[model samples]
Target: MRFFNTEGPNRADDHYSLPPLSRWDLDAILTLIEQKKYFLLHAPRQTGKTTCLLALMDYLNREGRYRAVYANLEGAQAYRENVDAAMAVIVTDIAASARVWLGDTDAPVLAREVLATTPHGSALSLFLAHWCQRIPQPMVLLLDEVDALVGDTLISLLRQLRAGYPQRPDAFPQALILCGVRDLRDYRIHASSEQAPITGGSAFNIKAKSLRLGDFDAEEVATLLHEHTAETGQAFTPEALARVWELTQGQPWLVNALAYEACFEQPEGRDRAQPIGVDLIDRAKETLILNRVTHLDQLTHKLREPRVRRIIEPMLGGTALGEAFEEDREYLVDLGLLRRDGAGGLVIANPIYREVLPRALASGPQDSLPQISPTWLNPDGSLNPDRLLDAFLAFWRQHGEPLLASAPYHEIAPHLVLMAFLHRVINGGGRLERAYAIGRGRMDLCLRDGAVTLGLALKVWRDGRPDPLTEGLTQLDAYLAGLGLDRGWLVIFDRRARQPPIEARTSSHETLSPAGRCIQVVRA
Candidate 1:
């Protein structure tokens, strides 16, 4: 059975996949290749860049217009800055690819000859020149993992390519496409011997264009899910289909991982008679996050980077990122951690990411939390808002300070600490959802525990900032309206300078909002 693939590049015979060429501008690619232009095909780690490149190579070769060979340069990564060793690995890999893809057995022999006669710095260039000279058809090189090399190795590869750019189909490949996770311009390659960083652009300015392989759109997501139904006679309910799109926003890896979890791994999902539903999709999402699967784990790992933290911390706490924004924001967008929304503003890529990021950040604090009774639960098993608020106040007074120290991002420590507490409150039965955005000055959370649901808004009162009470109440009022709840909590963290210790000032009170909605105000 064809299934959603999570481990690696998609293969048509085994995996359910869309046409790779449809992900980007095929005409533009054709134009570049026809013009004998060197360019880049880049995207996030698992957005199917390799799949697209392989497909392009196959398409080009089948047309008999160009002899296209796809080679992965990841083997060179092991050699690091050893330019000579890395060149040997790359040349041999290209030769192997040519033998397999083009049925050309002589390329491997050419590789050994090239390495022996040519200098390490120019071995790749010399090898490519020799291969093109041997081949009758104009050759195209689709080089994957172009960004895998570091320092001098990367510099040498780029420079060699640039040096050979003037030679056409006879002396070098007619066209070359470098594929990796970032654009060539994003690489600030620093050689060990050089005092300053060298940008990839300077090393290889021959790139004519940069093509990004993008995620699937909504229709593509639905088409993939329905493919299973067509094949197995099992269906996804309308709600489940919409839920998948909502949670994933058409991110290819996420879309596949969620479906693979729900349809294959989950015991009940294996029965073709039982259709997939929203509940199952929700469970699948939870499973992916809880299992800390490779994809999610890698996504969270990126959060530790300072460049990532600068934007994410403010997004988590719902405040402006200040002036340190421009280039860093672009970097995040390129990394696929954030995206340009319909309004041209940056947002956490999708809903699932929005949930996973904070939870990952709070995992440290969540682990160190002290034990407490489920005092917030009523006899009937639903949550009691009043009781839950009381428990949180007590928990904050006793352990909040120490727990704050465990949080990874200190700027949003209070938010993480509270999220940690709520995660405990769920006790495996409910979910806590959060919504925060840059420059919003508020973080809204909704807790759904069985029959009970509570809405809460979090705000931080910083040293130079005005009190967030009025702002938070208004925000919570809007939030409650969205959740269709009349009453909710507004918890404001007092981070102002010289503030009293947490225990003495942590308190709550009931108040009426401007909209006359009932709100419990917690000042901690």
Candidate 2:
């Protein structure tokens, strides 16, 4: 009866689950609690932080060493417009959770009494002070989705907790853990009491540490899948496991989603008894991405956020503004969109995410448009860039005007359209690596056709600038230097210099520099 859990917390009986506490770094967390230290627990959405905290709460409460409660403040989202209303909901939710777990409904009454008596600016701190005074054992509070509260409400919560820090073990919660997608340090909150910026370090100043719950390791992922094999006598071939890891990079939701699709959704022919293999995983990836399921859709919805766009645009352009790069880079990493690359800097988190995102964000035409023929691909499994780009240029001349007319992604339409065209051709055959960045001069794309590696560098020009041979040659030289490539192709999207209708668009290849390296220029 066990199944993959794509939704909320996994149950031992209903879902194939990991050993309680086995999936998290619980020892470190417990050490913080024992030392009376406040800390952070964060990871991308649905990566099991809430589940881990709930389990930890149970362990602590059942041990009878402390009173622990896990409370989600997300319900306070509605109070975003009214600070007083938001505070009331927060206090009530905390009280309700405490009542259920601590056998203390009166907790709220005492908290409200404290708030009524305390000074206007410090009500929450005083309320927590009162509640802590009445509780018998030391308390461990796990605040989930604390980042969901915006502006002042967030500041109040952090400041209140900070104010109550000195009363640990008596009148305050010992071992407070704040959980959200962002670390506490990223919180930018300002309050009426202080005109200056309130760094999280100052507001939640007592935090002894910030601990991010990481995704499962590859071995752990295999072990999770293996449990199903043990129970149902079905097996996952080694190739399948590798495919899953390559695609998901051990992301929890993705891991579960791939397995769910392969085992349950794949056609029976492909889901045969011969241990599930790489082909099945590939098929699952294609089907899931093409279908645009709720989980994938929700994650991409973040693309509309300005912060997300700021980070993503540079990646699409293959260059990033150096200033403040680290902070935004860390934010994207925490979002699970990018991961550290030992030598290559930061790369997209995984192949599946890389493949899914562009398509997911591509406008309506890309999704609903007619499929391009595979005629451009050679029988030797090679893509003739000269032919492909030329053919695409012709197609663009004919339909690009119409497509770009209604395209909402006007600034990046050229890139998306080309990517979509390439994706259609390489849909089932090869992998295309997309590297673009906001304000970065060029978009670098690497096409891997088994043994052949082709690099395409695209530069965008706004005005009718003269031929960019000198600048383009220099940039290409630097890019080729890093890529260890000798020759490559460059496509320039000159906003003011489109080919004269039907008669002028053409592709030309020529040698550049004393080295006489080949570079193709496709003017469209």
Best model per TM-score: 1
lDDT tens readout by residue for model 1, 123-183: 8999999889989899999999988888989988988998988998778999999998877
Task: In model 1, state the lDDT of residue 430.
Answer: 93
List, residue by residue over 1-524, the lDDT tens digit for candidate 2: 68778889888788887775987677777888999998888888888888888889889999999899888999987776366777777777887888887678788787677556665357666777777777788889888988888767787777778878888879888888889987747455544355354554566667677778888889989988988788777789898998898889888888988888888777752444657788888878878777877777877787776566666655665545455456667877888887777775777788777776676655555764565665666787677766676677767767665555444356666677767666676665776776654445777777766555677777766665676555666777666667777777777765664545532543455657334657776554
Q: How close is candidate 2 to the true structure, as a TM-score?
A: 0.80
**lDDT per model vs. reference:** 0.90, 0.73
Candidate 2: RMSD over Cα atoms? 5.1
Q: Pick the candidate with the highest lDDT.
A: 1
Against the true structure, what is every candidate's RMSD? 1.6, 5.1
Clashing pairs in 1: none
Worst 10 residues of 1 by lDDT: 192-201
